[model samples]
Target: MPTPLYQRLAAHYRDAVAAGSLTPGARFPSVRSLMAQHEVSLTTALQVCRVLEQEGLLEARPRSGYFVCHPAGRPALRLNEPEARPLDPAAYVGMHARVSEFIARGRQQPVKVNFSGARGAPELYPAEALRQAAGRALREDPELFVRAGPVAGEPVFREVLAKRALASGMVIAPEEIVVTQGCIEALNLALRAVTQPGDIVAVESPTFYGLMQVLESLSLRVLEIPTSPQTGISLEALELAVHHGSKIAALVVVPYLQNPLGSVMPAVNQARLVNFCAEQGIALIEDDTYSALLDEDVPQRALKALDRTGGVIHCASLHKVLAPGLRLGWMTAGRWQARVEMLKYAQSRHNDGLPQYAAAAVMGSSQYDRHLRRLRATLNLQRRQVSDALLRAFPVGTRFNTPPGGLSLWVELPDRRDARALFAAALAEGILIAPGVMFSNVERYATCLRLNCGNPFTPEVAAAVQRLGELCLTRCRPGAVGSGAAGSAA
Candidate 1:
């Protein structure tokens, strides 16, 4: 049942009082003002004031109406520790090992169906194109095999990437491009270039956990704002935080096909956000990692394209759609092009030329468009099939957002059931999934889970989904499924 109107209204006033917006001895607004502000009935407004008065946030005064009571409770504010401290060189060395461990864990475990990642089918990679490109490079330029490539990246790949950036609405020159191992390195370099140890950064709640690790490594404090799984960040809340001098060095966002939750910000909101960031002097790092996988006939203009003030930093990778092992990624930093490039030079100098050439060959081919079309068709069909399967397999009350395009699904199970528990059970059944707790800041998304629909529709996947469904029923009910199913899960 929906909450009572007066109870909701009373709690709002109580929160305001506790937050110190309505201080002690401050005059309360009249019943008419409350009526106008809340658009509630007179009785409801009176009830709200009565509840507040009883709770000691207000007091009755003769002829003057109610006055705010003294000694309101305010949340305890403490010194926020910087995410990192002055770490010696040893710390950086240890940090690398820690990150390596994270990546290794992601790959070493074999799941029943491997719905843990949004990786595409390896069969779709253009093997023949890569072979031909490597052969041509070796034959046409034998000297290229012995020498080190340019620190910036391969020239042909840079030109292609620049042209594609312009097509996506970014006004960029070839000189502004910097290629790295992949999007991970691209983001890492961007952060190293812009942020310092002990700096504060604002990230969307339930962001990519990989980004969280980056923040941790840098010792950067994270101020999380509630982000809508559909529309990106809450702009008004961001403006408020920035106004309070949050010392936010950058705002990293995935405006196109955001991870875990496939949300695309509308063009109008994108423009508003771009302007807001510019006016507030906050740098916007736009991560378009999944943009290429969009199934839309007309893709939305990227945030970098709408940057009139040179505040948007654009990063993307070919690993998602084309070649993961290629590890080729590029970025266009508007004003900090030099800083970004220097960091890239310091990191790995440049990615291997063979892979870049191979990716470039495939990207530069006629089959590129055909391959994307086929991929989209397959993805769209699979999306429907997976959604239907989930609906049919799981019982009622299982909720998830319906993304227009992308590979993953964000599902919210019944509150009584924990996704971590489901994860343990599924792992035993050889099914692995990304529990939603990993995506959130407060780790409150215990009942949420993300599913991958891009992999092959194997019999293992079918059995895993069926097992997951049965587990859901058992958890949501006291004794819905028999103990035999639970024993099998164990």
Candidate 2:
């Protein structure tokens, strides 16, 4: 469990560079000198030097020794929390164009370091196990490949999902579950089932852009509620909105490992939210996509589990923890099961049976649990590594919250800094990051940003973080200019 010698050496130099002890263009100790100084073997010294080089901290000159090439440490900024802004009336979703442009740029010029999406690295998933499971399912049930299943889903897959739901403290019958293309489709179906055009829906402030797109596509008015990075959506603000005649029809919330913020709602708050929704006749749509990624020993119960009057609709997917390519997602619509089922059928006939059988095969076996255990551990470690890099690389005023269980970190830059500008500058350097303004319907969160920590923090990842830090420092410094130039590139 102790840190490896090479890693420790790398960290020491990384810290030195971050602390200004090692200035840019400064020469690093030779490999032999490093070995003699640290009493480490030549191989250990070489490995440490290689790691530092890979991290963009040290660079090798053709025939010369290694030299510190990274930017010097700047004064740490005072961490500032994003101020909660008032709810803005629903506006036309214009993020589609911006998001599309960002995506197109990434494709046109492939980014060296991608921190834009929330998906886990493919290496973290059990691809071989899933493939074997799918092969077995195909051999056992050949009909699954050729026959179309029911509108809701394949009965066997639904049954497997129902059994799996029990781990999250939900006990629902298989018939109540409806399979969809993914969580996004499930969300669309759930929103369509309970909401009408122009109806007011409450969402967490700084919510995922996908949800905003869904609301926009449906022509729904949004009411942004003040949310805490640590505790999730504020009940007090939500109750006030309801009492003040917001005419809110439905509430969509990501209670566990919320996107962007990575906050988990407390169990007490979860119960309170369910009861409040029931009393107020508001349908609560829970996006539980990341719920399965929580610690196995202390799994948090779903809001659907606490619903007594069937007012909670649970939407979840196995893509994040299992097979992302499968595009498998399910929804349990408590009281509006019929409506959701009908909406799903109308939108798209039942999901493909092939992937369902494949998923079912994996879920039914012990390999699924083992894979989850490894995934949870890997994600946690990756998150820590990224956090360390951010702290060391970013300016002093940078702020961030440690997520309880999630794949991304929400970072708040200095008040004077514009994350959108940083995003542009980073992209120019072949690094990709999610801007905070994309998450909000309003122009708030201009100083905030999100970083994907789902992938393992390899040397390339470390270098990317360092490059971002350098860019941020350049734009945010007291006498710095070119913020406009950075934005112009985008």
Task: State each model's CA lDDT, in order.
Answer: 0.71, 0.81
Model 1: lDDT equals 0.71
For model 1, residues 1-490, the per-residue Cα lDDT tens digits are 9999999988888888779677544568888899999898899889988988887678775666787654413211111111221111112112334434434655666654777777777776666777888888888778776789988889988887877676687767877888888888888887877788877677765677788778778887777655666576767767777776566778888887788777777777798988988987888888889877777755457898888877888888888777766888888888888888888887788677877776777777778767777777677656655665676676665666556577887776643466766776776666778776566445345566788888766666667777788987774444333332111100
Clashes of each: 2, 3
Model 1 clashing residue pairs (backbone): 84-219, 112-430
Q: Model 2: per-residue lDDT, tens digit, 1-490?
A: 9999999999998998888677554568999899999999999999999998877777775556887653334321222333544456655465666666667776777588999999899998988877887888889887876788899999889999999889789999999999998899999999999999989889998898989889888988888887777678889889888887788889999998888788788888998999999999999999999987865446678899888898999999887989889998999998899998888878999888888887888898888888888888788778767877887888776767656567988887753577878888888888988887788766567677889988878899999998898999886554222333111100
Off by over 4 Å in 1: 1-110, 475-490
lDDT at residue 486 of model 2 (Cα atoms): 17
Name the runs in model 2 displaced over 4 angstroms. Answer: 1-85, 476-490
Query: What is the RMSD of candidate 1?
Result: 15.0
Clashing pairs in 2: 76-396, 77-396, 77-397
* Span of ten consecutive residues with least summed lDDT in model 1: 75-84
> Which TM-score value belongs to model 1?
0.75
Candidate 2 least-lDDT 10 residues: 481-490
